[model samples]
Structure formats: C-alpha cells, structure tokens
Target: MTTGDRCEMPPIPLRSTPIKGFILDITGVLYNSMEGTDGIPIQGSAHAVNRLYSESRVRFLSNESTGTVGHVVGKLGRLGYTGIREEDVITPAPTAAEYCKRNGLRPHLLVHPGIRSVFDGLSQEDPNCVLIGDAEHAFTFKAINTAFRHLMKMKDPLLLSLGCGKFYQRTDGPCIDVGAFAEALKYSSGCRHVVIGKPRGDYFQTALDSMGLAKDEVVMIGDDIVSDVGGAMAFGMRAIQVRTGKWRSEWESHEIKPTLIADDLLSAVKACID
Candidate 1:
C-alpha cells in the first residue's frame, strides 16, 4: 500500500528533528499479536515502513519472544512489509544466545516454543544461566518455581531477560509479557537480571550499532511510553509515540516527552520525512 492510498487522519504537527535512522517496535507499532501474519496491519504501517526503508536505514526492533529472527522477517513479508531481512530485525533471543556463548554459560531457556530455535546449540543440561522470554504456554507456576530452584543452586548464575515489557496488545486485549515473570524470578532468587530488550541500554545500543549512526541521529517510534519512548529518549535517541495498541491517555503526564505524537506509524514517518 502506498501513502496516497491511505485514509486520511488528522495532521500531526511536524518536528524539525533530523533523523538518519529509525528503530521501530514491531508488535504494537507495525503489527499486533492478534492474527500473526494473517493479522490486520496497522493502517499505513506498511507504507510508512517501506518509505522509511527507501529513505534511510530502518531496523525492526521488537521485544516479542514468539518467533526467531527468520520467522519475524518472514512474517513481516507476509504482512506486506518489504525489503526487510534477518539483519534488519533485532530481538532478544539472538542477543541472549550470543551473550551466553561469549561467557560460556549454559542457558536454561524459558521462552516460547516457537522461538527456542534461536538457542538451538546452547546448553540446557544443568544450566548455569537462566534466560527468560515470553514463554506463553510454558509460564506456569511450576515452570517459574523450577527456574527459581535452578537459580538458587547455581553459583552467581546469570539471569537474562529478553524483554521487561509489562504487557503486549492482542486482538482480545492486553496480554501479560515475560517481564512480570522475569521479575518474579528475580525477586525470589535475588539475582539482578540483565535485561537485553527495550527500556535497557543494551537493547538500544544493539540497534544503534547496527545502523552505525549516532544516537542523536536516530528516532524510535513505538506505542509504549515507558519502554519505547522513555527508553529511547534515555538512550539519547529522539522518540515518536503513536496512539495505537497499548497507548494510554495517562502517558502524557509522564516526564519523558516524545519528539512528536502521531495518530499512527504513517504520521510518525511523515513527521520524519516531510
């Protein structure tokens, strides 16, 4: 879909802030968890993302733990987003795997079954590290207690969190993410988690490093104020908040102001481009 084909929305006041690169959140900004690839695209999201790709470096940064990098790229293509590759996307799975390999730590992965492929070669037997992601069906009380028990026995065990997002938007409503579970484990085990996703410096740094651009030259567009806007702004990147998915009126009262507020992703891109 092209920009001209989109139904008109109210104009958002443009910002003069120069943006050389873009870090876009996948679930709430470009798509939601309702129908996966068959899900409805946020209006003009595909168009905006395509346009931005044509103009500058754009990275699909998502905290979603449902799929591997390849799966995410395929899903985007199936949903009409073009020109995205494995390298164009960043998620906590691969990042966590790399960290584990670098430190020679065994991972006790507590992620969704769909995304476990990211840690195919990692050690799971008598793991010395605990890595948590949105485990969906696997996040039962038994699982949490088992992970907590494992952490208690290890010496300085590593606790890695892919995302600390409180909730994600779904077709039905907001669904709890792995962040709540991760926190529970942290509280019980008394191990400080190394958060590798949004609202953390490492997550922003990974995206910034991929673009090879200064933080000041990049803009993050997302729906969550705390994770997307506040996180990016804290990392020195300008942020644009979109009133879609999990956005709330109460976010405006927060101290972390976005560079611009738009009705949707298309408007956010227009502010950056036009």
Candidate 2:
C-alpha cells in the first residue's frame, strides 16, 4: 500500500527550539470545526496540552477575534483542556486593546460584536485609527465604508489589522478572514496598517513577554504554515508545523520551512519536552 514514489516522511522529528514557553494556535491545532460551534477536539491535543503544562509555560495564542478570551477558555475546558487560565489565552481583540492603551490611539472599532467588550475602556470619542478584526457579517459595505471614511479623516490614517490571514475554514466552507478586510481598507484609505495577530512579530513578542520568556527560549506550534510556522520563525523562534489543521503536503517545500514538522500537537509537544 505504500507508495514508492514518495522519498520518505517520518512520523515526527525532534525540533531544536529550546522549550520554556509554548505558543499554540487554537482553531485547527487544538480543535477542528467539524462538529459545529463547539469544535471537536483533535485527538491527543488535550494530552499534548497536559504535557505542555508540565514542561513549559504554555500560551494559547490565536488570531481568533470572534469571541472573548473567557469564551476560549470555557471551550478548552469543555474539550478537556484543564488548568488553562484566562490570561493564558491571548487573542487579537484584547491585544489590540492593549496596543491602543500603550500607543494612546483611539480606534474606530471594526471587530466582532461578541468581543467588543475588550475595547470597552478604550477611548472611542475621537477614533484616530481603524482597528479591524474578523467582524464576520459586520464587514458590510456600510460598515467598511464608514471605517474607510474614518481612516480618511484621520491625520495619521493608521489601520491596525487583527491578523493577515486570508481565510478560515468554517463548517460550511472557507470564509474571508480579517486580512482581506484589512487589505481592502488599506487599498481605499492607503493607510499605514499594522497587523496585530499571528505572523506579526509584535504579536508573538507580546505572547513571549506574557510568559516571561525570550524568543530563543520559546517554540510556536500550530497547523498553519504561514501564521504559526512562518511567523514564529521570522520572529527568531523555533516553530513546529503540525500535520493536523491547515497543513498541506505541497507546502513542505515552502520558502519558509519550519524548524521541524510534527504529526500533531502531541508530537510537537513531545519534541519540545523530550
């Protein structure tokens, strides 16, 4: 049954990234969207998380802006990932909020309604920058136009995009992600945009800072090649691309290769610990 045409692919290989902090992607790496809203856990993922706790300070870093950090923790618990605290989970929405606070830039929010509370304390009176996340249906023309107009009015005209992911897979199909919206606004407003989520070095730095670890001491694990693997590597950290999520065999020869590839989170974690 084995194909002779294949050169050779191993089950998993040990990565060279030293282990102090673990940065994991949520959507495809932990659980998949096969069973509706509450996605079914990928096999061995919970076990991998358990091992991560014993070995390193793990942070669930995701581009997910659909729900609050609290919601992500709850979902993790339901899916049998225990000992995870709210602070351990980082998403673009809250990160964006913190970015606004630090920079003293009031943002015109273009994010999901569920996570709007994250920006509650931020000044909205005179929004100077446009903060765009995956607003799902909120990406309507009126909304986008409003955001565009706001950006046009701003003297600086800055757009803070959540993540530059082009699309995400839903149960129905793949839908346009926040990156697309960010690009659209960028095109219209010609504003200087900063991506706030995965593949953004700052975002990974934020996660590492939260864990009190330097980039050299941390390893990023995710299913996405570009976001998880490519991003972390670019940030000067070791990255392990998992076979589960959005991974494809053709991408094995991508320009930005991972430090090593693993069969899944369990394998990726094992490589970190063992």
Candidate 3:
C-alpha cells in the first residue's frame, strides 16, 4: 500500500480456509473519531464486514474507551455495518478486570470516571489497577504527580493502558495521542504496563475464544500496521493492512510491516479471505 489517496479497488481475497470470524480495529479501520476527512466509506469496509457476518460468525473488536458499547453500536449502524452484537466486542479494560480477578489481583485505578464504564465489574473494595483513559481536557501536573506518587508505592500492581493513540495523522503531521502520557508514566515509574489495546495479544485471544474459532480460522483486518497487523501476527493469525489510517508509507518506513497491504478495507478483506 502506497501513501496518498489512490484509485478505488475491488474486494480482496477471503482466506482459503473457512473464516470462523474476524477481529477488527475500530479507530482507523472502521471510523475516524474526528470528522471531515474526504472520508471514502473506508472502501469496502461496510460491505465486507456485512458480507462476513452473513457468511459466517464475525466479531468487531476494538480498543475504544471514550464510548460505551451502545455508543459504538450506534456509530457502526450509522456507518452501515449492522452485523455486530454488543457482547461480540472485546476490549482490554474489561478483559483486564477479568484477567485480574482470575489471577487474584485487584488493582487501584487512577483513571477518570467516564472511562471506568468500559470495565463492567469493578467495585470499590477490590484492589485497583491504575486505569487511564482519554479525556478532552489537559491533565494538571499536580494530578500527574499524584499518580506518580501512587505508582511509586504500589508493588507488582498492573499498569493498564487504555488504547489511546500514540500519534494521530493530521493535516499538518502526526500529533501525540493522550496515551503518550501513560507511556511516559510507565517509563518514569519503571513499572511494566500492559497495553491492552492494539498490538496486544490479549484482545486477539479473547476474540478468538469468544468466537470458538482456532487461530488459523481467523484473519485480522485493520488499517494500522502496529495495532492491526502486528497484533494479529503475534497471535499467529493472518493480517492485512490498509493504506488508510496511521500507516503512512514514508513516516513509518521500517518500524512496522503488514503481512499484506491493501489499498482499502475492501481489498484488505479480499486478501484476508484468499
């Protein structure tokens, strides 16, 4: 896939093996949160996703924390993708809670109230994991400092990251995502943070488990090479990267590579099935 807007392409190959389901990345692959790009219906995205649903089981997996499942479903409906159910979606936030519960580790959270809605089972009594989500306003230095203080005191606590974008593609250039703050905190605290979003294998495994599908029967389709392609590759599933989203050919020359690159989601979907 090359940079810049290119010509329209037809649907790509579906995998030769029967595709039990698909795990999708929401932000760049399905829809951009910000409006007003010369948005081209994400070429074959709706049709391919719908087609997959009609043909076999399909799951829409994302790392979005800004909205709840209902909100996401509404947005997807607006985009003309109607095959998904709320339960079919998977995110690291809820998964992390389950992960912690399964491991007998409760974590104290440092995230905003709105973001906590994504994780369903947290109670005040449970030990908290420092949960961070994206907010519209700037975080005060004092607040960050306080979080750092807690980070210093906790022993073997999990630092869970909400999938905040690292860099966003804008009219000017790539700008930092709020998640970069979380990244910085993880570095300063010398605590290993498990990023549950893109590029993380946890969400992938969760989707596969929910679908009752083997890794070989699923293909991951997305726009970002790191979150979509890298994550899928790590899970031993095939990946197809569309030229859309954060993957500019020149900017990220060697940092990440896709198993297959397509001009758009439709072409990418076709590749996945082939």
Candidate 4:
C-alpha cells in the first residue's frame, strides 16, 4: 500500500502453532487488478511468496471465476511470481462445472465467457440449474430475466453461486462482484443459491486437501474479511487479513476478526513463518 511496485512493510510476530501450508487469494492479495487483462504484483509479495515456497506448500484459492486452471498459473507467472504450480491454483469455474456434472443438473450458466468453456460437456439442453460467477458486463437484464424464468419454472430450483463477495478492487476503482448479481437473482426468483467458492467449507477443504495439511496446520491469507477471514475461521483454521485489494477500514470492526492483521502480503508471509 506504500505505493509503486514494492512495499516497505516490516516483519510481524507469529503464533505458537506451526503453519505448514498457505491458501492465498489472488486479486487483491497479490496484486492490484488493472487493464490489459492482467494485474500488477503488490510490493514484496512475489519475493515473500517465493521465500515461503522454500519453507511451506502454497495453494492459490481464488473466487476469480474467469480463467481456466492453466490461465490462473499463467496469470501468476506473468505477474512475476515464481513459486505457484498449476494444480496449486483453484478457481470456482471448474469446480462448479464438476458439481453440475455430479448432480446431473444442466445449468443455465450466467458465468463470464472466459471460463464458460469449463461447462462444455454438460448438457445445457434444459438448464434446470442457474450457475452464476463474475460475469462482469454480461449480466444484462435479459440475461437475469432469462435465468430467473428458468429458476421460477423449474420443479426444483438450483442456483449455484460462485462466490458471494460484494465487490473487488481494480486499479481504476472498485466494481461489483458476483455476489451482488447472485443476490439480485435470489430475491427475484425466490430460489436460494448454493455457494461454490471461498467461505464454503467444502471449497476450503479442497484447497486444504491440495496442500496435504489439516485445517490447524494451514493459514488462509486474503483481503475480503468476510469470505477470507470469517470463512476460514468458521472452518476452524487461522486467517489473516491484509489491508490491500478490496480492503476497507470499516471492516476492521467486523464481528469475525482475523487471527492477525497486517499491512500487506509481505507482513502476512513474515507472520506466517515467524
């Protein structure tokens, strides 16, 4: 947050329990989302992460529903990161698609076109489900109305929401996230949407599994206090909130407090290992 590419944050104190794995949030935690379809890496974050790679396993758990798993890995490398692996990255799109396949539900997908391919094999012939993600500008009135009609008319309505965070940070400014649109649909259709991404215990468990660590042996580092800190705590794991990305001062008073709060990722990494 100090400015430019690098941060000037100092190392922080640590907790007694040893943390062997990390679940990281991409957008606001690692870098500031910018134009050109990628983002800028936050100061010292790349270095801190690389250093952590020497000590512990890392899994990038993001509700960033846009890219394929490979693209997620590429995005990290393009942002100057070196320690992340393809399987270490977990996004909601593919996971949601797998859910649809497992449940035999054909989703009237309201997701971004970028990740729309993941649901390719599934039958959208008679979409009994409505799966929503960060569709950005694609959430037209017609689109929502169409999806609403699907849910209202279905014998059993199923709405799978990718993640429910209200908004995320971009270099220019803040923009509405998937949760806002998902809520609107829920209110209009009177159908409850199932959460598919962060804060969801199963999703956290998936990330935890990828790390081969139990909940107590891992730490969740992210920006959104609700989905990241609150969710991780609810899953019985320690969580750390960084004052970057979509971070707001008002959230500091939120009911769910982080195990520790830091200025940015650099300090969070230091605290993770200290």
Candidate 5:
C-alpha cells in the first residue's frame, strides 16, 4: 500500500524541532522478539523512517545489549531493513562504553558473555562504576545480590541500564527485566542509576546526538505510548504513538497523550509527513 493507502490519522502541524533526522526504538517499534515473521518485509513498517532518511540521516537506535552491533544489523537486514549500519545502532552496553571512555571512568561490567568480548581497555579491579545490562543469568537472585554487594562499597557508583523492559511478555507470562534488578540495587545500595533506553531522557539524548538534531526537529515513533511518546516528549520531541505491539484499549486514559496516534506504522508515518 502507498502512503495515502495507509494513514488513518491526519498529520498535525508540527512546530518543527531540530530533529532533522530520526531516532527509532527497536523492540516493539521495529521487530518483536528480534525475529522476523514470515513474508513480512523489514521495510514494511519503515516507510516513514526511510522517507525521512531520504532527506536526512536515520539511525537505527536499539537498546539490545545481548549481542554486538553486527548482530543487530543482521537481524534488521533479515527483516528487510537495508539501511542500518554498525555505527547507526546504539545499545546501553556500547553507550556505557562510550560514556566511560569519554569521562575516563572505567567500570566493572556485568554483561552477557556473548557481548562481553566487545569491552576494551577495562578490568575487574577498582573500577569506577558498575555497569549492568541484559544477561542470561541476570534473573537469578544470586547474581543480583552479588552485583548489589559490590555496588554498595563504591562511592557514588552508578548503575547503567540498557533498554530493558520493566516486564517482558512472552508465551508463558510476564517477567521482570534488568531494570527491576537495578531498582532493587538502588533500594539496597542507595546508588542512583541512569537508564539508557525508552522512558528515559538519557536514551533520547544519545539518539538525538547521533542524529545531530535538537529535540524539536525530530519525531519519535514507537508502539508503546509510555516509552516512545512519554520518553520523546520528555526530551521535547514530537511523538507519534502506534497502536501495535504493546497497544491496549486503556491507553486513551493516559495522562500524557501523543501528538497523534495511528493504527500502525504506515498511518503513523502518514500522520507525520502529511
């Protein structure tokens, strides 16, 4: 279907922020569970992102920390998104790495072994901070307690969370995410954390910096109003909420509303560009 065939909502008159490019969320907005459905093109929902990219650079920002940038690029390519590159993708792990590098703060990282190899020039002793992201073993109380105890001793140690949902919905049921673990640490250790994903301004800041745009010119699109809309609005960017993935009937009652809402990505894009 063409752009006209898709949009169900009228595009609001945007005041125009410095967001000449776009910063996109991956999980619910791009793909679900990092897997591609049969016959579904990666580009299927990417029309608006591509349209903006044609005129401006589009960065495929994600919070997945389980794998390296190559893993993310491969997944996107398999889903039919051809524009993503290694540098375009950002995750909490990498963001933490960069933050450490720039600030000259080396922290002991607790990442999944798969992506642990990506950390360079860091060691286990006397680290400046404790960086936590997604880990296959992260759910265990033993793991959490161990990390928490170490954090308690550090002076002003910061917990950095890559984009992880507070709860994840799967075939079996809902489950806690690394953020909950981080929260537990906060409660116990009394150390503050900086989240680097949806619902947090830090993640948006990273995306905006990557896109080289101020908050106003960029548009935030996602399937979840809480993360996508709320997060984007917190950063002063226009937001479009898509009624897919995490969309439910009660979202209309939310205290914070999107600039516009649509049935799907196509409609959301139309609402933005039209």
Candidate 6:
C-alpha cells in the first residue's frame, strides 16, 4: 500500500482476519522498563500475547543496544512471558555484526559490554568502522573522542548507528539515546551514518524477511510514533500505535499515520484479533 492509504484509528471489528505474523516492540508495547521491574502486566497484554503466541508467528523487535538477544529473552521470561526463545528476539547488535561481516569492515564498537559478544568473530585490529549504540555509562566524552580520531584517519570510514532514538524512558526518567551522539559525529566527520534499527526500511525488512511474510501480511505494534509506527507504514506494513512509552499529543500532526491507535498493547492486540 502507498503512504496515502492510511487508516486513522479505525474501530476494532468483532472479528478480523487473523494476522500471519506480528512485529512487536518490547519497550512500551510488551513491558514498561528495560529491567522489567514494573509490577503486573499492562492490563491484558499478557493474555493477548499468550493467545497470539499459539496462532501467529511472533517476533520481538527491540532497539535496545544495552543487551543481547539472550538478555532480552531472559528479561521477558522474568516478566512471565513464556515460550520465547533467543531466535524470537531481534536486536541491532546482530544486525550490525552481519552488516560489518558482509562489507569486510573492521569494527570499533562503542556499545554496552552486554552485547559485545554479538561481534565475537569480527576483527577489531585496524578498526575502520565506528559502530555506536546506547553505551549508557560507557558513553563518555573520551570514548566519543576516541571514535572520532579513528574516523579521521580513514578516507571514508563507516559509521553505524544501532538506533536513532532521541531519548528513552529509563527506570529513573528519560535519558539520551544514541541518536544525539550519532548526529554529533555525522556533523563533525561529514560521514552519514547508516542507521540499523527502527524507522529504517532495512531494519523492518529484516524482521519481515525472517518471518517469510510480505509487508502487507504483517502488522507492527509499538509505542514510538516515528520509529515503530511511521517506519512500519513506510515499509508498507500496517501499524498500530499504543499510547504508552514515548507517546505524545503532537504525533497526530506527523505526516505518517497509524492504521489504528489503541490505549496500550492489549488494546492494540485486541484490535488485531477481534
């Protein structure tokens, strides 16, 4: 479908066609915090997920750069989500690793230690490419300067950003995401960084390809209007926006629209199934 073919917050039907596959965002749609410390499920989210798990191919797509696929799976398990495996989760670390391997670029990683294992086989000797992610405590000025120096030496070095999210809701409050840093480097280095997660066509395409389903056959459910909803819509997939995490009133003014808008993930899934 084209960008003009948008469905704006349509009412949920009594019975709709069962979706073949589902692309779910973890941060807001599935759970609240990264640590899964928030008490209880978001109303009926658990029930909806459990029901869909039996019938549809579900994949958890996250922009979280601090953890590996295994780490995310473990967190989900702790939050009482059953039947989830490592393969069911897709994060930017693996995608970045694959991109670097395919292009024969040596990586200078600026990501969290938790996800460092994703690039295990890759060479880091003469690091020609600088890969940036949400390194949290490790994202010091020294680290950024170090990466900048490495980029200056190469004629056209690669800069890979895991996600370009402006900020994320942490346990305490909202915190800066990798996008800010990525933009800074882009301005300084004059190198356009290739974003590997959310809102990027290739990122959504990767998830769809893994499920072996066409874009039209799948639906993307998430809270971020730009990355999750707008990105999926741009990729020709139906999207549902949940009013949870980083949702704002100004999202309605954006050019890209969601097929439906639900109160939360449970409501969004209910719109999908019923």
Please tell me which model should have the higher lDDT, number 1 or number 4.
4
Model 2 TM-score relative to the real fold: 0.89
lDDT of 5 by residue, 46-79 (tens): 6655775676666665666777888777877877
RMSD over all Cα atoms, model 2: 4.1
> Residue-wise lDDT of candidate 1 within 28-79, one digit each (tens)?
7887668433455788998898898888889988887888888888888888
Ranking by TM-score: 4, 1, 6, 2, 5, 3
Clashing pairs in 1: none
Give me the displacement of residue 159 in model 6, in angstroms.
0.6
Highest TM-score model number? 4
Query: Model 3, range 128-165, lDDT digits (tens) per residue?
Result: 45666554343567766666766787776456676656
Model 3 worst lDDT run, 10 consecutive residues: 6-15
Question: What C-alpha root-mean-square deviation, in Å, does candidate 3 show against the real structure?
Answer: 5.6
Error of 2 at 60 (Å): 1.2
Kindly report which residue stretches of model 3 are placed more than 4 angstroms away from their true locations once superposed: 1-18, 35-41, 104-106, 119-121, 124-128, 136-138, 169-175
Off by over 4 Å in 6: 1-18, 34-41
Model 3 error, position 99 (Å): 2.6
lDDT of 5: 0.67
Candidate 6 local lDDT, 77-153, one digit each (tens)? 87777677888788988998999999998989888888988899999998988999999889899999898888887
In candidate 2, stretches whose alpha carbon ends up further than 4 angstroms from where it belongs are 1-17, 34-36
Off by over 4 Å in 5: 1-19, 34-43, 46-49, 168-175, 200-202
What's the distance in Å from true for residue 95, model 5?
1.3
Give the TM-score comparing model 4 with the true structure, all chains together: 0.93
- Pitting candidate 4 against candidate 5, the one with the higher lDDT is 4
lDDT pick, better of 1 and 3:
1
The top-ranked prediction according to lDDT is 4
lDDT of 2: 0.84
